[model samples]
Target chain A: MNNFLTHIGRYILLMRLVFKQPEKKSIYFRQILIEIEHLGLDSVGIVVFISIFMGAVLAIQMAFNLDTPLVPLYTIGYATRQSVVLEFSPTIISLILAGKVGSRISSEIGTMRVTEQIDALEIMGINPATYLIFPKIIAALFFNPILIMISIIVANMGGWLAGSLTGMVPSGEFIYGLKAFFEGYDVFYSLVKSVVFAFLIVSISGYHGYYTRGGALEVGEASTKGVVNSSIAIIIFNLILTNLLLA
Target chain B: MIEAIEISKSFGDNKVLDNVSVKFEAGRCNLVIGQSGSGKTVLMKCLVGLFEIDEGRGIFGEKVLSRMSFDEMKLVRQEIGMLFQGGALFDSMNVEQNVMFPLSMFTEQSIGERLERANFCLSRVNLENVNKLLPSELSGGMKKRVAIARAIAMNPRYLFCDEPNSGLDPHTANVIDNLIKEITEEYGITTVINTHDMNSVIEIGDRVSFIHEGKLWWQGDRDTILMSDNKELNNFVFATKLTRKIKGL
Candidate 1:
């Protein structure tokens, strides 16, 4: 219990020291460029692949379950809503981001730790956590929801195209279904979830990466821990948010 | 001047440094020499407040780090410059950026002024015309030079180097040693060096502290250290076959 408390206490110290660091505006442009370069571009292939598959899967599942054959539009409506707001947009995006952003944060930080770059910062009177992690957090916070939103639009389009040609659903109903189901909560819910998920992913990964010890093998371990922990935390937090916000 | 009194550190049940007290005089190289895992690194860290001592006091000039708050410690840290074993250059930054990092962080120097100072420090370390190059582009010796340039860019009152000559050829190592010695004297900075190299000891050490079994075992100058009849020091110095052949021991 005491060890666990101290673990939490270090983060508090980390936060205080992070706050005390001089404003990192000097590195802002470089940070943003690096983040977008890494988190967005490096993961586009995976994001696209995941989103397309998720959308198609959701459409097929909803179509199989629905009994509204006379008005098949309900199948498309249910698929669009659930996939966009509940699962594909937030949950799937979070998973993809975890695979993308989390690993990079871990490895970059782990390398820094191994090379004593973080220690160099500390001795120079710079806060390593602030210098290293803050820009990443900010980039993840700002860019993730945007990426999620893009993923949603692209995935829904994929689902519509895939469903129409394959006879999984009728074309007339698919377009009408999406138009008719206008849940105001879809955009808000997914955006909120994306933001919170970004924080969890960035912070946990950064922590794991920064404290990496040993050598190359240990850095690999830290990277694995980073992705696994972030993905699990994102899922767990998803349920908590859903219960709180939806209930 | 830096002084450590009764400094001790442990990892769980394993004691790393035990009741080690040492003082570093200003305007000279205070060398800490021991084989690997002799607690030299831990002792150096304890002196710098990088690692907290289990029981001891570290006085940088007059203010003791053990008793100071984070804010107060920050003030004392301003007087410190460190060259880590691996050079620890910020890879993302260019040579100029890495050297100017300290100035930009602690001082509100104008961009022009910071660049000028960085250029000057780099020249002082004999690193020239490589300001725009990344660390990856530099040779191992060049990287070490850049780290030294960064360390002294702040014109610190105190300097510390951990295994500064590690991984370098003897010739490059000697050059680095001479540069550190020259800077220490020129700036009158109290320099503390953690080294295991005998060449470094003979070349730069004005005062050498031998740490053995987590204790300060012996203290003296390079000339005296070489001539000491201490059995352990003799064994350490003559461990290699070549050294043994040279010493006829």
Candidate 2:
């Protein structure tokens, strides 16, 4: 309990430092662009691939479960839409990113720490935290929701294709059901969740990385911890926000 | 000049530096030497504000470093430059970009101006036409030179080098040592170097401090090192058999 509280306190302190005023706007802006490319553009393929498969699998399972005549054929589309918008797109994709993007941030910072690059920055009178982590967090905030939005669109298309091609449900019914109960608030909720999850993923991973000590073995450990901790934080926040917003 | 006045540092239960004080004068290479684990690096880190000193203060000119707030420290640090043991060049940036980094952060100079300064510093370090190469592509000696170029980019009043010649061949190490001495003299910067290499002490150390077991053990110029009666200093200075034979001990 003591250790946990200390980590939480330290994380909050680090966040404060990360968001402090930067020394140079031009340098910070360049860093933000670089981070956006790494965190957002680079992860597009994997997010798309995973979203499509997740949507397909969910649709197939719903079709299998609701086979009886009591259930309408269009219900598969409704179920897939709800699953993608309410949970899968934001939560699962962020969890995936906790493994992908989170680990990279941790390892990169951890390597910098061990190699004394961070100390070099400090000795140069630069706030290393503000210079390194702030841009990454801002980039994640700007880009993660966009990624989630893309994931939602592609996942729905995947569901439509799977239902129509497999003959599990008529294409017309699937499309109709997708449009039948479309609540704009669900999309809004997803965006909200995505932003929060993005903060958790980037900040938690960055905290782990920034505090890393020792050599290569310790850097590897920090990376693992970054992924695991961010993934756990994403799940916890997902549950809390879901309860508060949609209970 | 940089002055450390009774600075002490510890990590948790282990004390690494104990009430150590030393003055590093300008226009000379002030070398701090010790065996491994003797707290040489810790003292340097404390002086650089990378680690908080447990007690006492470091004075850079008239400013007391330990008493300064974050912003004040940043202002003081603008006049400071450091070269790390491993060069610590930004792995993602090319040599030109790495050298220009300090300028970009601290100066309002145009990109052309920054580029010119970067090129000049690189040339001063005897490296030419390799600005496009990444740090990973450079040899160990080249990396050190690039790091030195980057350190002096802002024309700092004070410079610190932590084991600047570690992991280099003796010839390369001598080259780096002489380069440090030349840069210090040319710029008239107060340069403090942390090193265990005796060759560095002999070559460029105008003034030397020896720390042993977290304590300041001796202070003198390199020429007086062989004549010192300090047992710990002798044990360290003449540890090698060749040096012991030369000292007739």
Candidate 3:
């Protein structure tokens, strides 16, 4: 009972510390720049390409499913809006980010843990958790939303192509579909999922990497665990949010 | 000074260290000698706050490590320098960056100043003109030297080495031992080393503590180690055929 309480207590304390005032401890502007390059800039191409594909798929599916004469022209636009502002943009973007960001976090921290670089930071009076993990969490939080926004835009472009191909809905109708839902709720939902997913992936990967022991074998395990666990958590959370918001 | 009182550690059901206690003083190389699986590393880790003690208190100066707050312990930790068993230099950083890490974090020094100190330490360890090389490029001896340089970059008040001489040839190990001893004296830093090599016990075991089965079996200077009557200590100290022959046993 005590151990369980203590575990919860520690996690709460760490969360508060993580979310509390900005720590000047480990800004590591250099590392931040490197990670931003890796997580944000370098990842843009894949996210954009994936978004286009997702949008195209949604438009094609909607075109095939449409049988009602009254709403036939609205199908591509509605499908594009639903997928971009809600599920596809946030969920898919995060899944892709996990492969890039989460794996890098695991490898970097795992290498540090084994090399004693983390301990070296501690011995120098810097908190390894604060110095190493916090900046990563911050960078992920900072970059994920922006990347998600880009994903949504590219997906809309893809939907336009798919809509134009089917002749079921024109590119103009797809633009109209997006503008119709421009009450900002769709963007809000996407942002919400992106931020939450960012936190989950960065935090879990940090935890896994920080506690890594043993040798090369353990580092490899932590990397695999980081990607698998982060992906699973992202999906589970996505499902819950979709139900709660769209139900 | 550092004192560990009744330190014990275990892994699952197996107890690795049991009620080990001792005091290590400043400006002396205190060697913890034991054979493999004899709990030497556990004790050293317990002293360095790496292994959480099951039941013990580690007192460094006036601070009680077991009773410390996370933040408070971090403050004390700043004064510690450790050379890990595998010469845990960051593979990503060049030698200069590795040595400058602590200074860059904890000091107000400019980059120029940090680099100067890093270069000084590098040269002190007999490394020169190789600061641009990554850890992979360095030989085993050079890696250990770089680790030592990183440990002292902070001008730490205390130093702990886990098997500093483990994988090196005799010449390299002797050089590392002498450098550790010299640094301890020069900086007036308390140094603790964990090792099973009897050769180390003779080289610079200014003060020696013997651990067997997790207990502090004996404590003495290197000069008296060969003459100690304690069977456990004698067995470990004279386990080598060389020592046995000298003792005529």
Candidate 4:
């Protein structure tokens, strides 16, 4: 408990340091662009791949279970849509990202720490936290919602393809169910969760990396811890956000 | 000049540096030498403000280190440069970008101007035509030289090196030491080097501070160090067979 509190306190302090104004705006701006490429754009392939397969799997399962005469065939599409938008795309995709982007941030910064690159920055009068972390946060904040939105679109398309190809449900009925009673608020809720999860993944991983103390082995440990901790935070936050936003 | 006045630092219950005080002269190589755990590196880190001292203070030029706020310390640090043992060049950046990094962050120099200055610094280190190479692409000696270029790119008033020649051939180590000595003399930068390498101590140790068991144990230069009668210092100085043979002990 004491160690946990110490970590919390140190994390808060690090956040304060990380959010300071950049020493040079131009340099920071360049770094943000670079981070957007590294952290955000780089994750697109994995996000799209997972979302498409998951959507297809969810539709297939829904069709298999809801094939009774009492249930409407359109129910498959509706269920798939809800599952993709409200849960899978936003929540599961974020968990995947907590592993991908989270590990990258942790290992990169952890390597820097072990190599004394961070100390080099500090001795140069640069705020190492701000110089290294703020750009990642900004890049994630800016691009994560876009990634989630892409996941939503791509996953819905995958559901359509699965229904059409597998003959689980007719195309017209599936499209109608997809468009049926579509709540704009659900998409908004997913976006909100995405932004929050993005913050958690990047900042928590960065914290782990920033405090890394040893060499290559310790860096690997930090990376693993970062992914684990951020994934847990995502799960917990997903529960809270789903309750708050949906209920 | 840089001064460490009775500075002390401890990690948990392990006292790493205990009331260690020393002065580093400008325009000369100030070498701090001791065994592996003698707190030499800790003392350097404390003086550079990477680790806060539990007691005493550091004075950089006329500024009192312990009294300076974060902002004030940053402003003072603009006059400082450091070379880490591992080089610590930004791995993502090529050599040119690495050297120009501090200038881009701290100066209003145009890109062309920054490039010109970086080129000069690189050339001063006797490296050229490798501007596009990554740190991993360079040899260990080349990496150290690039690190030196980056360190001097800012035209710093002070330079600190922690084990500047830790991993290198004896010939390359001599090159690095002489380079550091030349740069120190040319720029009149207050230079502090933390090294256990005897070659460094004998070659360019304009002044030497010996730390033993977390305490400042002795002070002298290369000439006087060989003849010192201090027992611990003698043990350290004569630990190597070559030095033992030279000292006839």
Candidate 5:
């Protein structure tokens, strides 16, 4: 418990350093663009591929269970839309990112720490935390919402395709259900969750990486811990945000 | 000059540096020599503020390090340059970008101006035609040269090197030693080097401080070091049979 609290304290201190005013805004902007390419843009393909399969599976399963006479044919589409928009696209997809982007951030920073590159930055009078981490946080915050939007669009199209091909539900009914009772606030809640998740993933992973000690073995350990911890945080916050925003 | 005044550091119960102090003068190569785990590297880290000293303080010219606020310390750090044992070049950036990093971050120079300055530093280190290569692609000697180029990019007043020749062949090591010496003299920078290599001491150590256990055991010039009567210093300075034979001791 003491060790955990110490880590918490250190993490808070690190965040304070990370958010300090950048030495040069132009350089920071360039770094943010680079991070967007590495962390956000590169992950698009995987996010799209995974979302399609998940949406198809959700639609099929909903159709399979809604076979009773009392349930409407459109209920399958409704359930798939709610699951994808409210939870699957935002929460499950973010968990996937916690594994992908989180590990990358941890290992990159951990390697920098071991190599003394971070120390070099400090010796050069540059704020190492602000220079190394702030750009990543900004890039993720800007691009993650767009990625989530893409995931939503592709996943719904996938559901539509699965319904037409599998004959699980009529295409007209699925489209009608998708358009029916559409609350814009659900999208807002999802975007909110994605932004929060983006911050958690980048900051938590960066914390693990920045404080990495020892060499190769320790860097690997930091990466693993980064992914696991960020995933857990995403799950916990998913529940909290759901309660706070929707309930 | 940069000075450490009775600085002490400990990790848990293991005291690494105990009230150690030394002064490094400008336009000279100040070498800190010791056996492995003798706290020489720790002392260097303390001087650079990488590791906070438990007692005493670092004095850079007229300024007291411990008395400075974070911004003041940062300003002091701008005048300092460091070369790590492994070169510590940014893995993702090419040589040119690595060398220009400080200028881009600290100065309002245009990219063209930064490039010209980076070119001059690289040329000063006698490194050319490798600007597009990554650190991993260069030979060990070349990497160290590139690191030197980057260190001098800011025209710093103080230069610190930790194990600058640790993994090089003797020939390459000698080349690096000469380069550091020339740069220190050319820039009139106070250069502090942490090294265990006796060759470095003989070739470039204008002033040598020997640490034993956790104490500052001895201090002298390179020539005086060979003739010192200190038992621990003698054991360290003439550890090899070849050195003993050369000294006819």
Candidate 6:
């Protein structure tokens, strides 16, 4: 318990340093754009691919379970929409990113730490945390939700296509079900969760990387730990936000 | 000048540096020579604020580095430049970008001005037309030169190089040594290097401090080192068969 608390405290302190004012606003702005390209643009393909499959699988399963004629076909659409919006797009997709983007951030920073690049920055009078980690967090914060929005849209399209192809539900009925009980608040909740998950993923991974010690073996260990920890944090935060906002 | 007074550091129960005091004067190649694990690197790290000293202080000019807050240290660090052992060039950036990084972070100079300064520093290091090349493409000696170019980009008052010639051939090492000496004399910068290479000690060591087992064992210039009577220093300086042959041992 004490070790856990100490880690939490250290993480908070590191966040403080990460948010400190940058030495050069112009350089920081450029870094943010680069990070966005790395974290958001590069990962879109995988997110879209996984989300589409997830939506198709969920729609098929919903259709299979609601095979009775007593159940309305539109209910499949409603269930798919709810599942994608509430959990799959934001939570599961982010959990996937906890392995992809999170591990990359951790390994990148860990390599820099072991190679003395962070120390080089410090010796040059630049704050390593602010210079290296802040832009990543900011980029993730702005881009993860955008990715989730894309995922939600694409996943719905996938479900619609699967419904049509599988003959699980009529196209008209699926469209009606999607539009029948739309809640604007669900989108808001998703965006909130995505933003929180983005923060956790980047910050936690970056912390693990920045404080890495020893050589190549240790860097590898930090990367593994980074992915594991960020995934766990994303799940925990997802539950907390769900309870707070949608319970 | 950069001065360390009674600087001591330890990692948990293991002491790495103990009451080691030294002064590195400007316009000289100050070398800290020691065996591996002798804490020369730790001492240098302490002087540069990379590691905190457990006792005493490091003074850079009129500023007391040990007591300065992180914000306050930035002011002093701005006047500092360092060449890391592996060069530590940002692998993602090309040579020009790596050299111009410090300027971009600290100076309000226009892009054109920063590029021009970077070009000049690159030329000063005898590297030309390789600005767009990545560090992975450069030779080890070239990487060191580029690191030196980056280190001096700010025209730092104090320059620190940790194992600058660690993994270089004798010819390349001598070239690096001469380059450091020429730069120190030309720019009148206080340059401190941590090295275990005897060749570096003999070639460019204007003021050398030898550390043994976390203690300052001996101090002198290159000429005096050849005749020093300290037992540990003699053992270190004459450890090689080639040196013992020259000494008629």
The alpha-carbon deviation from the true structure for residue B58 of candidate 2, after best TM-score superposition, in angstroms, is: 0.6
TM-score of chain B of each: 0.97, 0.98, 0.97, 0.98, 0.97, 0.97
For model 3, what is the alpha-carbon lDDT of residue B71?
Answer: 74
| Structure candidate 1, residue pairs in collision | none
- Taken over the whole model, the C-alpha lDDT of each candidate is 0.85, 0.94, 0.84, 0.94, 0.94, 0.94
- How does model 6 score by TM-score? 0.99
lDDT of 3 by residue, A1-247 (tens): 9975774575456566555433344447666776677667888888888989988888878877875777757656876777677888898889888888898888789889987777766666666776677777877888999999998888888888888887867777777776764657778888989999999888877766777898889998998888888899899999998787767
Query: On residues B46-67, what C-alpha lDDT tens digit does candidate 2 reach at each position?
Result: 9988899999999999889999
TM-scores, one per candidate: 0.93, 0.99, 0.91, 0.98, 0.99, 0.99
lDDT of 2 by residue, A28-135 (tens): 999999999999999999999999989888888999999999999899999999999999999999999999999999999999999999988988889999998999
Error of 1 at B79 (Å): 2.1
TM-score of chain A in every predicted structure: 0.91, 0.99, 0.86, 0.98, 0.99, 0.98
lDDT of 5 by residue, B58-139 (tens): 9989999988877888999999999999999999999999999999999999999999999999999998998899999999
lDDT of 1 by residue, A1-247 (tens): 9975785687667666555645456665577678876776666677777787777777776776774658455567556755676767888788878877888899989999999898888787666788788777877888888788878877787678767877877777777776675777868888889999998888888888888988999899999988998898899999998887777
Model 1 DockQ class: medium
Report how far residue A214 has shifted in candidate 6, in Å.
1.2
lDDT of 2 at A74: 90
- Runs of candidate 4 with Cα error greater than 4 angstroms are B245-248
lDDT of 6 by residue, B65-138 (tens): 98899899988999998999999999999999999999999888999999999999999999999999999999
The candidate 5 chain B region of ten consecutive residues with least summed lDDT is B240-249
Clashing pairs in 2: none
Candidate 5: tens digits of C-alpha lDDT, residues A31-92: 99999999999999999999899889888888988889898888888888988999999999
Q: Every model's DockQ, to 2 decimals? A: 0.56, 0.88, 0.52, 0.88, 0.91, 0.91
- Pairs that collide in candidate 5 are none
| Better structure of 3 and 6 per TM-score | 6
